[model samples]
Target: MLTYLVSPDDSALDHYPLLGNALAFWRSTIQQRQPFCPACRASFAEEAQPAAFLFATAAIAPTSASVSAFCMACWNDLPPAMIEREATRVLQQVIPGGRFLDPCEARR
Candidate 1:
């Protein structure tokens, strides 16, 4: 499985070269004030404050791709094992034939 750390300190493309469009989509989502959690579909605007973090993922294959986002709370509440398992599950649903091609270690 591929892991990426999306934060203010790092460039998304540097970690996942295939995430250029996905990053752009996430930026636009944030700019539009419509960021929502993919797992719960909770609106970020209702949080009473800006999101502490934006956890996003893109499942890409030669012919298919999809992107999703998660709020900081939901992301942090998950255990490391759960995160990997859920990420893999989400990726499979998004891109059925795609296998992660990026480095496996989390890029901090």
Candidate 2:
């Protein structure tokens, strides 16, 4: 009779160079964070039902990709050409604002 046995080795955590890079890749993905409407670009504060920048999210696979946010004011002020309705179903994965909808002073 013949038998096989398996042993666990956590040393793989740093057992090789390839293993190190793999750990970095996993950490990068899980630790990754994307903030929307950075204070430098927009405000998150609101009062008296002030307009809000609507945000959505989506999963994308690309090195150079971006996302946009839209306030009720910005949503209305945009030119028809700027708003990509086709992407409406898609969530704003990378909130950096691309093809903005523009903001307006008037209420809708």
Candidate 3:
């Protein structure tokens, strides 16, 4: 898998969608179709495949700290920067003194 980012034109992004956080995607695959990395775009399995692969990224935004990671098969193309942004976005929505709920660990 490619360990670097591509410098494709902005238009390439239009053709290639960016998959968000991996865990979120996994939980809602039916809601959102998975995205393929532009560098790895392939239509025929018989043909060669791209060397680039995506990965899952977990981070705390604003603070910009990573918390977890997973490979493309297990995760989506969530970069560190994107993770930070998503984390910070979540933190923003959580009320400081409001009621919050955490699922039971046994349930998982």
- Choose the strongest candidate by lDDT: 1
lDDT pick, better of 1 and 2: 1
Q: lDDT values of the candidates? A: 0.51, 0.32, 0.31
Off by over 4 Å in 1: 1-5, 12-18, 30-35, 44-65, 97-108
**lDDT by residue for model 3 (1-108), tens:** 111122222244244333223223433442244333232332212233222222222222231111122224212455656544443433334433322123475357
Candidate 3 ranges beyond 4 A from true positions: 1-76, 95-108
- By descending lDDT, how would the candidates be arranged? 1, 2, 3
* lDDT score of residue 55 within candidate 3: 28
- Off by more than 4 A, model 2: 1-40, 47-68, 85-108
Query: What tens-digit string does per-residue lDDT give for candidate 2 at 74-104?
Result: 3456554444442332333333243334336
Candidates 1 and 3 compared by TM-score, better number: 1
* Residue 100 lDDT in candidate 2: 33
Best by TM-score: 1
